[model samples]
Target: MELWYTEKHTDSVKFSIQVDRQLYSGQSEFQRIDVFDSKEFGRFLTLDGYMMLTEKDEFIYHEMMVHVPMAVHPAVKRVLIIGGGDGGAIRELVRYPTVEHIDLVEIDELVVEVCKKHLPQTACCFNDPRVHLHFEDGLRYIRHCEDEYDLIIVDSTDPFGPGEGLFTKEFYGNCYKALKADGIMVNQHESAFYADDAIAMQRAHKRIVQSFLISKVYQAHIPTYPSGHWLFGFASKKYHPTADLNGVKWNALGLKTRYYNTRLHAGCFALPNYVEEMLRDAE
Candidate 1:
C-alpha cells in the first residue's frame, strides 16, 4: 500500500505526493501541522492540509523574499518578519551580517516548534543572536510599531484563516506606519494560475498599492505550491525593486544563493500579460 498526501488546489484540481512515511502529525491551536518524508522532495510541512514548503524548492521562495528587497534597500539593519513560523525567511535573513536585529512575529507557536524539530534544514537559524522571536498576532504587533524597521517581510500563509487580517487595506496602512521613511515590505502574494488564488493576489496588490508610494508584483516557480507558479508583493515608500537595485553592491556580498541572483531579480518582475491585466483590473 502506498501512503499518499494530497491537497486540493481548487474545487476540481488536486496535488499529491507519495510519502515514504509520516514523520509527525499534530494539531496546533490555529491549524493542523504535518510532516512527511518522501523520495522526491525530502521532508515537507503542511498546515491545514495545505502545502507550505518542501525541502527541494524552499530555497527559491526564501531567497527571493529576502534578497530582492535587500538588494534594493541599501541599509536594512532592523527587520520584521510577520508569520514566517517555519524559519525559512529567518535562515536567509541571518546571512546578512550587516542586519543588526530581526523580529519574527508568528501567530502559531506550535508551527515554530514543529518546524524546528522536523524541518531543521530551514529552521536552523532561529537561535542566532540577531533573531528575537515573538509568538503573537502579526497584525497586532505591527499596529504597536511606528517607524521601527527598515525591512518588513510578511511571509504569511494564504489570505484566509489566521492570515486573513494581514491582507486587509487597514493592515497595509499599518505596515506603512511600522516602517522607516524608506522601508520595504515584501509579502507572499498568492498564485495567478488558479481563479481563487488569482483573486486573492489581485485584492492584496490593490490594497498595497493604495498604501505605499511604490507597489509591484514578482513571480517565482515553486512546484509544491498551487500551479507551480507563485507571486510575491513588493511595496515600499521609496525604493523601486529594479530601478533601485544595486547589483554591484549586492554581488559584492558574495552570498551564494541557489535561486536568487541580480539577473533573475530583474527578470522576475517582468510579469505575464494576463497577470498584468489582472493587476490592472484590480487597480
Candidate 2:
C-alpha cells in the first residue's frame, strides 16, 4: 500500500509527499508532531501538519538563515535562536568558529525530543557545548534581556497557533530592545505568492522596519513550502545585508554549501518587480 502526507497551503491548493514509512506521530502540549521517511526527501519533520525540515533540502533553509547574517557581520559572537526546535540553524552556526555561544528558546520541548529521536540530521548539533536550550516562551524569554546576543534568529512556524506572538509589533520591539547596537535579526518572513501568506509577510516586514534602523528582505527556494518562494527578513541597527556584506571574508571560509554562496547573497536580495512593489506598499 502507498501512504502519502498532504498539507493544505491554502483551501484550494495542496502539496503531497509519498511516504516510505511513518516513524513517529503524537500530540505535544502545543501541536501535533509527525515524522516520515520518503524516497525524495528522506526523513522529514512536520509540526501541526506543516513541513518544517527534510533531510535532503534542509541545508538550503538552514544555510541561508545562518550564513547570510554571519557573512554580513562576522564578529557576531553570541546568538539567540527562537523556535528552531529542529536544531538545523544551530548546526550551521556551530560550524563558525567566531560564534562563541548559542541560546535556543523553544516553546515546546517535545519538538526537540522528537527531532532528536527521528530527525537527528538537524537535531545533532544540540550536543555542542556552545548551545543552551531554554524550554519557555520565546516572546517572554526575549523581553527580559538587553544588549545580550549579537544576533537573533526567529526561526518560527507560520503566524498561527504556537507562532502567533512572534509576528507581533510588540515582539519585534522587544527584539530591538534585546540586541546590541550592531545586532542583526533574521526572521521567518512568510511567502509572497499566496494572498494569505502575503498578508503575514507584509505585516512582519512592516513591524521590523519600524523596530530596526536597517531592514532588508531576502529570498530562498524551498520546494516543500508554499509557492516554492520563501523570504527571510534581515533587520539590523548598523550593517546592510548587501552593502556591508563581507563577501570576501565569507568566501575565504571555504564553506561547502548546497544552496548558499557569496554571489547568491547579493542576488537573493534582488526582488522581483511584484515583490518589490509589495514590499514598498508594506512601508
Output the lDDT of residue 250, model 1: 98
182-270 per-residue lDDT for model 2 (tens digits)? 99999989899999999999999999999998999999999888999999999999999999999988889888888999899999999
What CA RMSD would you report for each candidate?
0.6, 0.7
Whole-structure CA lDDT of model 1: 0.95
lDDT of 1 by residue, 1-283 (tens): 9999999999999999999999989988898899999999999999887899999999999999999999999999999999999999999999999999999999999999999999999999999999999999999999999999999999998988889999999999999999999999998999898999999999999999999989999999888999999999999999999999999999999999999999999999999999999999998
| Root mean square deviation (Cα) for candidate 1 | 0.6
Positional deviation of residue 141's Cα in model 2 after best superposition, in angstroms: 0.3
Off by over 4 Å in 1: none
Among all windows of 10 consecutive residues in model 2, the one with the lowest summed lDDT is 248-257
TM-score of each: 0.99, 0.99
Candidate 1 has its poorest 10 consecutive residues by lDDT at 155-164
Give the number of the best model, judged by lDDT: 1
Question: How accurate locally is residue 65 in candidate 2, as Cα lDDT from 0 to 100?
Answer: 97
